[model samples]
Target: MNKHGIISLGEVIVDLIATDLSNTTFQRLLGGATVNVAVGVSRHGIPSYYLCKLGSDESSEFVKGQLTKEKVDLSFCSYDFNKEICSVYIHLNELGERYFHSYVNETPDEWITAEELDLEPFQKSKLFYFGSGTLFHPIARKTTEQAIHYAREENLKIAFDTNIRLKRWESENQCRETILSFVQKADIVKMTEDELLFLTETDTIETGLEHMAKLEIPYLFVTRGKDGAYAIHKNKIEHVPGIPVNAIDTTGAGDAFMAALLSRFHDNGVPNNEAELTEYTEFANKAGALSATKLGAL
Candidate 1:
């Protein structure tokens, strides 16, 4: 149980990306925001641990091989033969923006339990990362909250992402409530402009920012599709311009950005000033931009 390490908790699914829309062909790959972050950190030369569950299917086995190949620590991962690995078909526009066509709603990823994972890892990790996807189901939400409770007790730094998948939740209100609940517990929160508006129940991005600032969220990052991203650093919001790239698919870009930001957190610790936070934001924006230059989470 090494202290000061990183650990990510969330879903790991098989992403069937539509590489050729005209031909209706697909390129299968393992992806999920949480999984992307795990791989992203490892790719950046950090040995991160992933906590999740796999199912009793071929896709699950493939996921195992990929995680092993990525050099991510899977000692805390669990498996179930009764369930099948979930999947999704993502459609991409010329802009590389994603439109998910279909998702396998049934998966064992959300069934994660506290007893299934070693609690020692939580105590040893310096930072904990999780997304809103796991809040879709009661079982998953309970498990995730239990882990969050542990992180809190250990005084581990927490980072949360508002990765809203409307299809996963029953209602928009439920999603909003859960989103706010998790963000409240995080030291830093990342969201797209749309997600920010949704959580704030505001009509404009400015209005949303105004409302969120009242919540006293220490640091915030809002991603704008092509306009790049904005960040609230030391109580001041600054816009970081986007890096131009002929993106192949923008599937895992945010995860890339987050992984880079958190890896920097691991390297230099959290920013104590606006200058330092802005520098980190710019670096993370570049990491996301570079990810869009390629396809898939890898």
Candidate 2:
């Protein structure tokens, strides 16, 4: 029961990314924000435990095989023959920006429940990381909340990423409320600039901060593509410049950043001072930028 590992709970799906803007040809890969973070952290030499229920299908096997190959621990995962893994078709623009085109989900109701979760991983892990993808479903949302409660009881650091997909939710208000509820319980929160604007209903980061002032999120990272990211800790904001790199695909850059940041925290502990924060964020920015230079997220 090592306390250095990270536990990530969320959906793992197949990503059908268009080879180009033509939208005719696609390359299938195993991807999901939380899944990317698990693999990315594992690559950083940290023990990453992934928690999910996989189905008895080819796509599910592919996802599981990829996770195994990535060196991520699947000891806490489950399997069901009745359910099939989800697939998402993503379209990319000339700038390598991704558009979530469509989703093919057969068993939306089939989610790993809290009762099914093994508490041993929670005891052995140092951090609990998750995203908003699973929160749109009532059953999965209950499971996520239960997991969060377990994480709190274990005194594990909780990190939440607002990997917002508007198409998944019933309404904007529900999305904001559901995400904000989880945000309040997190020790660390990561979001893209667009996600921040959407959640806060504000035009800019400055105004978004004003809207989020009362929530008092301990550490918030708002990433803005090549412009780098703004790291807000204890009311002090520092702009960490993005590392320069030849752009390719921006699929899982934020997940890369989150994984790097969490890996740094796992190794050296969370940065408490400005100097430490800068060094940690700079390291993460480099990882994120490097990830964008690749085609697939994994």
Worst 10 residues of 1 by lDDT: 105-114
lDDT assessment of candidate 1:
0.83
| Model 1 lDDT at residue 262 | 88
Model 1, 1-298: lDDT tens digits are 4566788998888888777645277888988899999998898887788988877688878888989999988888887776677788888777756687887756444477866767877877888899998788887788788888888888788889999998778899999988898788888789999999989999899999998987778779999966788889656988888888888768789999999898888778888777788788888888998898885677
**Candidate 1 regions with alpha-carbon error over 4 angstroms:** 18-26, 90-99, 106-110
Show where candidate 2 strays beyond 4 Å.
18-26, 90-101
TM-score of every candidate relative to the true structure: 0.91, 0.93
lDDT of 2 by residue, 32-110 (tens): 8999999999999999999999888988888888899999999888888987999999998889777878889999899
Error of 2 at 292 (Å): 0.9
